[model samples]
Target: MNLWSFLQDPASWVGPDGIGARIVEHLVYTGLSLLIATAVSVVLGVIVGHFRAGNLLVVGTSNAARAIPTLGLVVLVVTLLGTGITPVVLALTVLAIPPILNATSTGVREADPGAVHAARALGMTTWQVIWRVELPLATPLIVSGIRSATLQVVSTATVAALAASGGLGRLVVDGQRLGASGYPEMFAGAVLVAALAIVLDVALGSVVWGLRRRRSRIGRTAAELDSAPAAEATPA
Candidate 1:
């Protein structure tokens, strides 16, 4: 069966071993890893960026993480921990952290200095400034980083099947085991993963767009307010 035929067949999507089940498994892996990674990266990034410290730490760690081969890391982890969701999630969490950390660190560090100064002038506590001013302003970039991390995780999650874990990748791996007859399953699995990535990217892109629009509107409003008194005082 060709990829199209496989998709059209209802049987391919039903039952425990069907495409639907595999997709759910894939999402489970992705969600677990992303949840953990985002929490760790965002917190660390905020602290590092806000204090303007740990630049070397953030940069060095992110670079080192990026350099690690994810597949090899997964294999090694599985070897030590034994094959299961824990090992897969651990490897994936490592893979997902760097982009989010870097993006968040850069975003918070570069939050409008004027805004930070204004926040300080208002007698806002340091934490208040972070929660109210810096974080809101930095949201777009943070989300963008998450988007990048998500794509990486989705693509790499396929390797879970190698460790006897469940996911859409199982289709590809199982298809390979079946030799030439499994080409359709492999193609279908690849296509599904790509589709999932594109859909998620589009969704996250919309969030980024909305955030930018809100930021632009806020900027324009601030500019108008600042000019209003000057405009009134000027000679007509």
Candidate 2:
């Protein structure tokens, strides 16, 4: 069947028990992997970003992780852990960590040194400087890292189907096994995966944009507060 025929076949993707359920399952797996990866990577990144010595270890580990090919890593995990969601989650989580850790560390390190220095000069504790000054400034970069990790996880999670965890990739693999006429089915699966990735990227981007806007508004408010006394003392 051609693309149009595939599109017209409602039963193919939307019946009571069809590709739709599998797609949802794929999304669930991807989401869970990303959530776990983000939590771990962000916390580790923050801790490493706060200290000079730890930063080296974080960067080195992140780089090493990124160097491991996704397919190879998936195969290795599957071999060790057996097939199903567990192996898939483990592989995807490993794939996601590097971007998050790198972005978070970069953001924290790039935060205004002057602000940090002033906080320390004021007798603020190390934790206080990190919590009150460094983290706020690093929010944008940290969010960007999350967005990157999320996109990676969504795309790669499809590989889970290869290990017997049903997903859009299952449709592709099964269709290919069925021969040339199965091209439409494979194409449909690819299109669905791409669409899902785009939607996720766009949604996460909007969230990051919202966060940046809030940060900007907060900065403006602080500026206005700083100028308020000067304005009041000036001639009316």
List ranges where model 2 is wrong by over 4 Å: 15-17, 114-125, 220-236
At residue 207, give the lDDT of candidate 2: 82
Looking at candidate 1, what is the lDDT of residue 91?
Answer: 99
For model 2, residues 15-85, the per-residue Cα lDDT tens digits are 53368887888888888888898889767777878885588788888889989988899899999999988
Look at candidate 2 and tell me the lDDT of residue 108.
71
- Candidate 1, residues 10-34, lDDT tens digits: the string is 9999998899999999999999999
Q: What is the lDDT of residue 194 in candidate 1?
A: 97
Alpha-carbon TM-score of each model against the true structure:
0.93, 0.86
Q: What local lDDT score does residue 49 receive in model 2, on the 0 to 100 scale? A: 81
Pull out the clashing pairs in model 2.
none
* Pairs of residues at least 3 apart in sequence or in different chains that clash in candidate 1: none
- State the local distance difference test value for candidate 1: 0.90
